[model samples]
Target: MNDKKEIRNILLLVFVIIIVGALIIAKFYGNNQKERYNISVIAGEAHAERWVVLQQGLEKAGNDYNAQINFYTVVNGKDAREQKDLINRELEKKVDAIIVCAVDSQEIQEVLQKSERRTPVILIETDLKPGHLYSQVSPDNYEMGYHLGEEFVRQQEGKETTAGILIDNDKIAAQQERLKGFEEALASAKNITIKWRASDYQSNERVDNIIGMDCVGTQNATEISKVNNEKISIYGFGNAEANIYYMDKGIIKALVVPNDFNMGYLSVQNAVQAVEKDMVYKNTIVEYIVVTGDTLHNEENQRIIFPLVQ
Candidate 1:
């Protein structure tokens, strides 16, 4: 009876030792696991289809990298104060990284200054003065515009052509740069002249009468083209769903489509890397595709105009 009791006690003691060892191993493993990162994306406009697609890409990257994303947008993308408020809110949230398309580069300066030391800030689609942020992910706006101008010159076929230009009034640096590049490239062709320039498409009286019109944004381009029933050749930026619909109907002659999907995906990926991996993030320039109705059916252009996800 004594021997049996001693044996039972020894067995119980071994079992307790095994249980304690298992708990310690589990705790160590849990502690060593990587923490998921949180990235925030602040776009100029939330409702626009382009930004919507960008959000899709951001989400995709978040999923791919095991990170979470908080996306914010201004009610009116052109309103600097609205964007500034959103930035401040994100800063308070203590996000790991911030990606923004600034409404007004200068207006966001002070807000960015507040985030400089705490978070990794990245610029997308639009650029600002570079000191406060980590890096920028955007297309070469000048190159995109220059390509559109080249297309315009080709369409004119050396005849004197009067073109109307509708520029965004929001003072987005990218838009202004696009307009500048287009103007400079078109100037080289003496046969093409910009006869009218206006911030509002409706305000440009010659929109319908001109040989062609260079629009800076997709919304205005689609609107003017539809309202005029394709009366003039329309060339512009953006690859929104409506823009694609208009292009299919032969309303928009050409579109300078940026790789917005890649922009979003890369921005998030880089942001997460910047935080967790101690990786160096730099300016990433996504390329643009000039899609026309003729080339829209092509496989590569189709991917740009009608993305699979967004």
Candidate 2:
């Protein structure tokens, strides 16, 4: 009888140990299974028209991907030294990765090299010089330009039409690609001539000057078939969506739309994914809309695409 009691006590002790061990293992597994990442976005400016929608999209992406986004704004992207210093500060934070909308395409490479030494970078809403950057998530600027170019060809079927670009006039990825795509799309058309000289290259002053240039189309409803600036069709890039609503009651035939909110949100989410998985994205092209008369009139349409935010 004494031996049997001792055996029963030992069995109870073993059962308790097994249950305790299973509980500990379950706790550790649950903690490790959850994935999280940290990300940063370097926006050119806080008040930029496009930045608003980009912010909304970024928020949406964050909710979807389970990540966090932090934004760093510069007074102006053109100030290279200041921009570099800003990047250095972000690097110190040891973010998993960074997303950039560079102010100057040329000088940004230096910043990229410095940050990339410690973490990966994803370029968003713009392009980067091709060698070492992680990935680019942006709208197809050139394709959007091509769509605009096609608008000129269709409208002027038989008439001679001229087109111009309002751009920064730099080697920036977005600017160069857009200019290239616009020209290619219009390459075969003889009646439509793209202005060899871009009258208003990208400058804050130039962007500010376009009160009613009809960068896309003659937005005035006064005359449905004719343009106010009949001879010239202008293409504005940044915050181009504003032209949709701001112009008098008419439709602009061609404009480029950026999915800013999505870009903002995805940039953060992708950076987090890169950190958690130790991986990076390649050739991730965000969506861009080619707005013509049919699409631009609806404010809701504009909101759905890029959400005229700034």
Candidate 3:
């Protein structure tokens, strides 16, 4: 009788243990299978060629992290008002997070700040004015500009040269920083002087060199150089297809290419992290590379300039 009672108690304990273990395993698996997060991205330019690589990076991250990305762009070019309106619309829908390449830092600062209180916000390419509420994932604009300036100075054979700067929008905070760094770099070399700074090309103005502060500015300068059959040396930022074509044709002297793929991938990855893990976001500086006509076809540079089709 005693042996039978002992055996019954042991079986009862084993059954309870099995049931508890099953419950714990189910709970753990359920936690691991989190629902996919929804993230929204608003780029400064809707049709910029550089976005191709960036969008790929974003999509890769989204796939890796189980996120659904909704990309938005300004239909009427780079307009701060349009960006604000988009932000409001996203907020109304209550997205999990927002990633924006601001058109005008000042114009969208307040709206972004308010939006951050309710949703996670991330900045790309440029950051807002000081004391911003969100984090940025971009190349060091000032440093990039400075390096481009240094490259320009290196190209000089100790001859006096006049350079004109073309920028898409002076209001863009990234452009402003790049412009500052370029100017400061030029300041050290008295031989090179900035003849004029304009948003659009000046047909009447002539200069030995033209420096584009953004991809649009670069493409504009390249097109102007090709059309006018001018002998001006063009140097600017971006790895756009147009830029590459011009560089191959020797119309563009050099380019400062940013890791746009990393920018896109990290932005999405960071956004997902901010939502799931409550991670404290901070500035994540991506890398950049300088490509000249001589080095454009090199294996390493090609990897940076051209995105791999996966």
Model 2 has an lDDT value of: 0.59
TM-score winner between candidates 1 and 2: 1
**Which regions in candidate 3 have their CA more than 4 angstroms from the true location?**
1-29, 129-133
Candidate that beats the other on lDDT, 1 or 2, i.e. the better one: 1
Instruction: Predict model 1's lDDT versus the native.
Output: 0.75
Query: Model 2: runs farther than 4 Å from truth?
Result: 1-36, 114-116, 129-133, 169-171, 193-234, 237-241, 297-303, 306-310
- Model 2, 1-310: lDDT tens digits are 9999999999999999999999999999988775655667786744555566677777777667765778677886456667667777777887667777776676777667655464778776456645454667777777766775666566667676544444443445676676677667778888765443342333322111121112222222112223343322334443334565533234344556666666776677666666666664555667756566566647665565645332
Query: TM-score of predicted model 3?
Result: 0.88
Ten-residue region with minimum lDDT total, candidate 3:
126-135
Model 1 lDDT per residue over 1-310, tens place: 9999999999999999999999999999999876788887887765767676677788889888888888888888679999888878887888788888887876776677755455777888665656535678888887888888887777778887677777664467777777777877887788776777776766555643232222236567567766776677677878777777877887777788888888999898778877765546678889779888899888887776557532
TM-score of each: 0.88, 0.72, 0.88
